[model samples]
Target: MLILWICFLRGARPILFIDGCHLSSPYKGTLLAASTCDANNDLFPIAYAIVSAENNENWIWFLSNLKELTGSISVTLISDRHPSIIAAVEQVYDRDRHAYCYRHVKENFCVETKKLQRGIRGEVKEDAKKLLDAVCYTHFGTEFTKAVEQLRAFSPELANWLETKGDINKWAKSQFPHRRWDLITTNVAESFNSWIRKERTHSICALITEHRDKLANLLYIAKLEMTKWNNEVGPKIDKILMEHVARSEFLKAVRYGDHNVMVRGSNVDVCVNLLRKECTYLEWQMTGIPCPHACAAIKLLHSNIYTYVEECYLKSSQEKIYASSMIPIETHDMPDVNNLTLTDWENNIFLMPPTTTRSLGRLCKKRRESQFQDVHVYKCSRCDQSGHNRSKCRNPNPEKI
Candidate 1:
């Protein structure tokens, strides 16, 4: 069994994913373990496990081994929020040392909400967005409570989801500012399934052993390629930067040119465009490799924007640096094989025996459900009671009949 985690910036594509695999089966106790991290830009195996015998204690032992490997006092472990994971975290991690992947909860909540709220439109959509935005982007405080109360007025079903005995308390504590529902999901780990799909012809152990090395090799090579590509692209980036500098100067000098006329990078006046969006920096930040608008503004003021933008965030930094600190270091003094432990599931104690075999059919049964929930079910506070939300929830009392 394997558990993988993908962590990403909210509203940004994922760039970090970690995976941990257990060698044992639910029915038997043979336990093995391994883990890897993929930045998509590169993949590296951070840890590995070898199960010598059948024991259920292997899972917890394997995780304990991982804690040593990870070297973090407070690790933000994210997964599908699997029941086993929740139970495991509670059992192992001390308070405030673990967090449930709110992303998974939001995903389930969204799916359920959509099923309940059907065919909602216009202001209803806006209201639903408000409620979700409240949870995703607001701190769990008075404002968040207000947002939830707002949703209650929009739809009874939504109000119930927020207020459910099991949900409200948990959701409140898990809430954070600037987080988004889409930020959650193990999609990055899901991507690796394809990597091993064609190579799964062998049994589980064989598949893992073979691909484990293969993945390690691939990651090493990928880092090298990323370095080369980043260097290769440097000249192109410099050229673009130079172009922005020239354009900014030309735009400033020319007063005779029509504002709407076609001119590369000079269409808008730099001084009068007060809205940041109307400025060049914001525009180029979105469409160009570097902030050409910042480049232009720099040239217009004879200031060095290069110094302002950190080298780390520069396009030039595309080359991934596989810091030796990030992975295990090879030292002669280090044991050829580190400490190993085997656990017997029956007694939850250490034991040793030959590896046992179980059918992969059981493994395939636990695949995640692929479904997108309705968007309407997450209604706004204004429209909670009636079919209509705040924008459309007119106070129409029936005539005195």
Candidate 2:
């Protein structure tokens, strides 16, 4: 993991996503992870630890080790609004570098809004929720202000709740530090957790070995995959640039200076400053790729849009990230414990599985369905009735009966 961290430091962005997953094994525990994203926006697991639970003490231990590993490099950490994580980050890393995951915020906001409007009439609650989402998604301060004003007009209490929780600079793209780019969620960590879901149930030693093997294979495959890339940037980044280029077709650009231009879309006008790599919409600076407005300006000036993209997104950097190889461990590589002296083996006997209280019910393997997830209803073609498929329908055909 330390070697992986060294490679990541050489090529990956200085952004980290931290999260903890509950282990469902006989000896229950928490799998705390620190992860980052590759140039292609893929998961890059850096470090992990197994702890008894997700408490402040355990989080502090995990983060302290991470801090030592990452050194004093300035990094932006993204995570859910977990109190333990918040406290640990405050104590370990610079508080200004932490950003709350927007997805978690939305989920928590929806749950709170439902409780606040338990018996309210009309669709006011739903409207307020939608407006809150708009506020979160807005990339410009003016648009954010308008959205908040609309929410206030609908419900001042809801607006106030959002304002109290939503620190503009932490969650809003317009005010967020541009170094972290447009990553707003800790999905990179979540994705890595999902990738190792089955392995999470293993014993601590087995889990570590599994992760070692998995990471080795992932790096090897990534190295081979990136070698074939022909573009200046990664595939995902190139696709985004192409999309912005397409959008630039609908925008009109007027030059004011050598590096400044005004781009007019159908309904809005944005100022693009190529020199600073900033646009009035904040997309260019936030994403490290030119927004449609900047794309228009670059096109008008006959400049290479690729030159404006951040160097971290280049294919060469991605290759350098996976250039280091992870040696796979084999059984023969293990030392013979039977040959060890009594003193050597006795001291290691204290290490044991974590202690946890057993729950009352059967352990659930599947995740609980989200409240917002659409429930699919099976329709019976034979009787045109919902909730039962044709094959499972109790109603028989008259002729067959």
Q: Each prediction's TM-score against the native? A: 0.48, 0.89
Candidate 1 structure lDDT:
0.44
**lDDT winner:** 2
**What C-alpha RMSD separates each model from the true structure?**
14.4, 3.2
Tens digits of lDDT, candidate 1, 274-357: 123233323332322334445544444444544443343333343333322123334475322234334324443433343656
lDDT of 2 by residue, 1-401 (tens): 67788888898999999999998777788889989988888888888888888899999998899888779788889998899999999999898899988777777777767776787654766776688778877886788899889988877767787778656567765556545688888889889889999888888777878888888989889888797776888788889999999989999999999889999988999899999888988777777888889899999999998899987898867977887898755678565657777886777753477766665899787898766669998977778778887788887552232
Poorest stretch of ten by lDDT in candidate 1:
3-12
Q: Residue 381, candidate 1: how far off, in angstroms?
A: 45
